[model samples]
Structures are given as C-alpha cells and as structure tokens.
Target: MTNFRIWAVGCIASFFLLGVSLAFISMNDQTQTTSGTDDLYEEIISNKAKYEKPAENAVIDKVWKKTPGIEGRAVDVQASYNKMKKDGVFNEKMLVYKRVKPDISLEDLPSSPIYRGHPDKNMVALLINVSWGEEYIPDMVKIFSKYHVKATFFIDGAFASKHKELVQMIEDEGHTIGSHGYLHKDMAQMSENQAEINMEKANEVLYALTNKKVKWLAPPSGSFTMNTVIAADKLGMETILWTVDTIDWKQPTKQVLLQRVLGKVHNGATILMHPTQVTVDSLPELIEQLKKNYRIGSVPTLLSENR
Candidate 1:
C-alpha cells in the first residue's frame, strides 16, 4: 500500500510540471507572433501607405474627421484656426507638403514642348493671380515687358470676363494663362455639386476668352479638396500651388514683400503674388536679386520627373 501511494504522488507531480511547461511554450509562441505583426504594420504605414494620395471620398472624410499622422495634425491646426480663410481639405491649394522628400527642382520643371530645344538656363516662371481691379493691367504688362520676362497669370473667370482686353493682353505678351476659379469661392465650404460648378464655369470662360485649353489651376486662398482635384483633372487642368507666398495682398510694403519672396523662393518654386502695385513695384529688384543669387525655372520645367 505505501509503494502504490508513492507512485500515485509522483505521477501527479510529473503531470503538473508538464502542464506548466506547455503553457509557457504556448505563451512564448504568441508573443513572437504579436511582435512580428506589429513590425509588418509599421512597415506598411511608413513605406507603402504614406505615398498613396487619398481618394476623393477619403479626402472629404479626412476633412470631416482627421488624418492619422503629423500631416493631418498640421492641417487640423490650420483649418481650425483659419476657418474664415477657407477649407483645407479640398481643391489643389496644397501643391506640396514641406515634410515630403525630393521636392521639385528647376531641372525637373516641365517646359513648353515647343521651347524644349531653346532652354533658358536661369529662367524662372512668375505666376501672378489677377483678382482685383483692371487699372493695374497696363502697369503689369509694362513692368513685365520692361524686365523682358514672361510670367503666367491666373485670372478669375468673373474678372476675366469683365476685362476681356486685359486677359487678351496677358496672352498676347507670350505668357502662360491659367484659371483661378469663377468667383473666388472657397472650395472647402462648397458641396460637391458647387465645386463642380465653380470649376466648369471657370474653364468655360477661360476658353472663351483666351482660346487656350486651360491646363493649370490655382485655388483662391490656398484651399482645396480632393473633389477640387478631380474637377480640375476632369477639365484637363493640372493644379499648381505656390511654394513662395509674398502675401502682397496683405498690403505689405514692397520691401517686406521682397524679403518674403527672397526668403522662400527655391528651385522649382511657383511663387504666388497678387498683381497689386506693391508686387509690380517690387518685381524688378526682386528679379534682379534672384537672377544674381539662384537659377530661376518655369513651373512645367520644375515638375519634370526626369531630373
């Protein structure tokens, strides 16, 4: 009887030890699997998912909600603070993000196919947004011609219609023409239908006035949505935003404007400024300084992928 009891006690102890060993092995396997899965998730987020441009629905959803990272964080802060300025989620207001790598280079900017052979080594494209009175048109043309430089003008459709001759003058000077929308409406507030309307109307009037297929667009006040992008794409227009904003519209002095432009202008930079008197007054000096310091390149040429 004593021997049988000992055997039974030994067997029970052995089973308990085996059970603990199995449990530990299972837990270790699970821990490894969890670690591997986390690593894979991070790889996807950083490598593949980061470059995918948001779809139309995704853009609107992000605007209403918020994107998941630092980019979204910046947009959220700006949108909340600048509610009166315009919506941040739509249109093509964001031409480039600062955090993105390998930005546009003068070597990369697309040139007019016709001008491909006659490349200007130090020519930069100037883009002026014309949304104000027409009294400055003559002065604009005169100043640009005086510098022997041709700058692109993005005109509001309503303004263009009223000043047909001025719009023609810009085109006649051998400068590029782009659309700035019909009424200067902020794209973030418009419903999808309204966004389409704004885009289509601008395209219509632009073609009517210039007889040129509008190939580019700039949203008023640097606001855009994915819908705005789609609309522009549908109209065969590529959206271009400014890398340098002179904020001449704020009535800054020509010196301040010049400082802003000089500080921000870079390779493949599409600088934005209104065709206000301040900008006109500042251009000659700014152009002279830029020519002396850096190579100026056109937008199309700046966006070339080959470089």
Candidate 2:
C-alpha cells in the first residue's frame, strides 16, 4: 500500500512539471514572434523615411543663395526655414533630376492665331519678358534652377544683342527662348510686312545665339494685330498670350502681388511677368503655391502634354 501511494504522488508531480515547462516554451515563442514583427515594422518606416523627406545635406540652401531675391540681400534665412517647415509642401525638395524629353511628334499644336496653350491640362506656363532688367536675369535663372522650373523667356532683339552671353546662358539652362519683337515695339501698329521684319530680325538673333528655332512669339506689351499673327505664322511661331498677368511690372508690394497671383491662377494658366524686384521676391512662394494644383512648366511642355 505504501509503495502504491508513493508511485501515484510521483506521477502527479511529473505531470505538473511537464505542463509548466510546456507553458514557458509557448510563451517564449509568442514573445519572439511579436519582437520580430516590431522589428519589421520599424524597418519599413525607416525605409519610407529615406525617400519621403529631403536629405539633411541637400543643396537647396546653396542654390537659394545664388537665387535672385535672396542673393546679396538681407534675408532672414532662419525665418524662411521656419516658414518652410510649417508649410509641408514648400519643404519638399524640388525633384529637378527628372529630365523632360521633347516630344517631336507634337509639332502640329498651337493651331490657332492666338495660343494660350491647352485649357484642359493641369499646367501653367511662366512667360518672362527680358527686354529690361538685365541685372535680375542671373538670380531669376538661379531661382528657376532651384525649383526645377522651365519658363519661357521672350527676348527683345536689342536686349539679346546687348546681352548675348546672358541669352546663351538662358538657352544652356534648358529654358525656352521666344521673341518679344525686335525692339519691344507694338506689332499691332505695324503693317504685316513691317511685323515680319521685326519678327525675322529677332528670330535671326535668337537662332544665331542658341541654334534652336524660336517656336513661340509673345508680342511686346501683349499688343498684336491680325498682321502680327500672320507674320508669326509665316515664321512658324505661335502667337502666345497670357491667361494671368502678375502686373509685377508696376512694382506692387510682395503681399499684393502674391495675392493677385494666387487669386487668379488656375489650371492651364500662362502667367506674364518681367524680371522685376517684385517678381523675384514673389517667385519662390508663387511656384510652391502653383505646384499644389498645377504643374509649372514651359509652354512647350504644356503643349506637348496636351497633344
């Protein structure tokens, strides 16, 4: 009887010990699985962070130093930096590394006397008249480069002749060059033949310098007649006009200029501006605002997308 009791007690103790050991093993396995899942989650988030935000050593600040409004001017860099941080969209680095290829098949567009680009596209063209403000061009170019923006620069023949190096620089930067008439004269007041002479003269200079044919013409002061359109068509250039005018030429305050642009801008809008102080001041912010809804590009880019 004593041997039987002892045997039963030993069996019960062994079973309890075995059960405890099994439970411990199961708990350890679950902990390892949970730990592995957490590690994977952290890795995924780290990988995403690598691409979503701009690198800490990005060259944007250096580029801004070369830009027009901020260069050689007393600008609060920290304030601008703080503002950019607050505005998440502006904080994103401009993805200018993407090279836009020209679509050779889109040569048949601008089939109208007055071209404002395709209204259906979610894009905007910046038309910068370069007859005056030679000092501002470099900064403007830098700003455009910083934003990876390609704008259309309409060169007056006189301006081109005096500033050939600047014109070459603009072309080399991959921006489109167009004619703003030979002498910034009103083409509307001239006869068809006279208009042709002005157009041809400007076209000749631009071609001589850039080796790229002028495909668009923005008449000075946006003044043009039927004769101007005929002359442009003869030269195989489209008569380009603006959908939005910044009126920066009048030297409006930065706040007012910004408000005017933001209030009037829409998809497929062509903004007319000159290389003025106001324009330089307003450009960076303007580009950021427009980028939210519209792809800011050259007129040719808009035309190609539409085609």
Candidate 3:
C-alpha cells in the first residue's frame, strides 16, 4: 500500500479503539450507579425502626444521683436512601439520624451530684484534676491540642493561687475550668457552712483569673456529702464526679492506664485523670482511640441536649 493509504488506516484504527474505550467506560459507570438500587428505599423504610433508638429521660437515681437525658435517634428514610443513591452504593455511613429530644431534661430534675452524662450519647468528657502533678499539664495540653480535643480541668484554689499563669494557660487553651475546692481537704468532713466557704473561695480565685464564672465543682478526692451538693447548687454550680478513674497517682504503668480506660469506656463516660507522667504518655493514644468510636469534649458538651 502507498504511504497515504497506510496513514489513513492507522488513523481509522486509533479512532475505533478510542470509541470502544469511551463506550465501555460509560457502560461501567451506568452499571455501578444502577446496581443494587432496586427496592433500596423500601428496604431502608422497612428496617428504619429496627435501627432507630428512643430518647431516654433524665433520672435522679438513689445511687447514681442526677443523670442527664440522652437524645434519641430517628432514622430519616428518605435522606438515607438519597445519600445511598448519591454514593452509588449501599453503606452504613449513609444512615442519617434525626435527633429526638427528651421531654424531661436534666435541668428539670432536682439538684444533686452529676457523675456521668447520658449513657447513650456518643461522647465522653475527660476530667483532669490538677493534683500535685503540675509538671505534666503542659504536655497533656499539647496532646489535646494536637488531637483537637477539649477537656475539663478541676483545680484546687491553693494550686491556682500559686500557679496563676499555669491555670490561665489552661483556660486560654479552651479547656473548661471547674472548682476542686479551695484546699485539698475532704469537704465531706466539713460542715455545710465551711464547705460553702471553701467552694466560694475557690470560685472567687478561679473567677479572678479567668474573669468567667465557673459552674461545675468536682470535690477533692470525690469526697462530698449531700450538703456539699446543696452548697454547690446554692452557688448555681453543678457537682460532677467521674465514671472511669485512671488512678494515675498510684503510678500505674502507661499500658495499664490505657487498658483500664479502654476496658471501662462507654458513651458519656467521665474519665477522671490527673497530670502524671503515665497519663501524658497515655493521652495521645487514648484520644486517638476514643476519636474512632466517640467524640472527646468538655463537660458541657457531653451534657448538652443537642446531638
């Protein structure tokens, strides 16, 4: 064949191959989009209630005291189906929930010590009592900052008074500050009047530094009587305790501390820890692990009614 004829044949072959490839790509995309779409919306609507959960009301337990209400989950069948359709496949991630507010909220319940948030909420609060391990705080804050998590710190008035700048740095880092009493003394051993005075002094000191009134009080060593709770309520503050106690002051190894947390961790858990070498070593891994299953936030965030 002549040179021009050969060239024409080559051009024809290239165009044919390009057309075939484009047709195959379009067909494959169409197949993926339409695959498993039959009866998808019906399936979602039928199984919607199976996956849905109900709102739990705030309860004042004789032992657990004031427990916050949990916002319920209601499936949005239409939205879930639409999301799946957009993704061109079925995935559990495509599930959508509409929050169902509880009729009786935590505020409606009588005042008492709050130990944990709603058990069904997918969040946990880290309560770091600024005990004697002051040196480890900066490192803890750095880890929290790295993970974009916020925690609540309960500090003693004596420590806050001595290390004003350290306390201020904590508040500046966007962590919530709660009173850990004026002195590290056991408030349960004191009278209502004395406990009130101790709480007031701590509040006054903390307010002087942050210029923001503290609303939560975690009694030192979890030693507080019902009178102490009443005193805190009188001051417009809520008493808080913890669900998971790290007990790092006992000098548990880093592995043991993480194991304790992972073993006992649940929705709305209030993880209590102190600034210690073990905690600072365990914090980064703890936050990363919790983020996979639950959001790490402050006390107010965990107890909030919003989903």
What are the models' TM-scores? 0.58, 0.64, 0.76
**Candidate 1 residue lDDT tens string, 92-125:** 2332222322333222322211111111123345
- Candidate order (TM-score): 3, 2, 1
Cα lDDT, model 3, residue 266: 95
Error of 2 at 40 (Å): 32
Most accurate candidate by TM-score: 3
User: Per-residue lDDT for 47-138 in model 3, tens only?
Assistant: 78877888888899887789888778999887898888765555666899999988998778877899888777889999999757788888
RMSD of each: 18.5, 15.3, 9.7
Location of the lowest summed lDDT over 10 successive residues in candidate 1: 65-74
Candidate 1: what lDDT? 0.63
| Regions more than 4 Å wrong, model 1 | 1-123, 295-298, 304-307
Model 2: residues with Cα > 4 Å off, grouped in runs: 1-111
Model 2 residue 62 lDDT?
Answer: 25
Give the Cα lDDT of each candidate. 0.63, 0.74, 0.89
Model 3: CA > 4 A from native: 1-52, 73-98
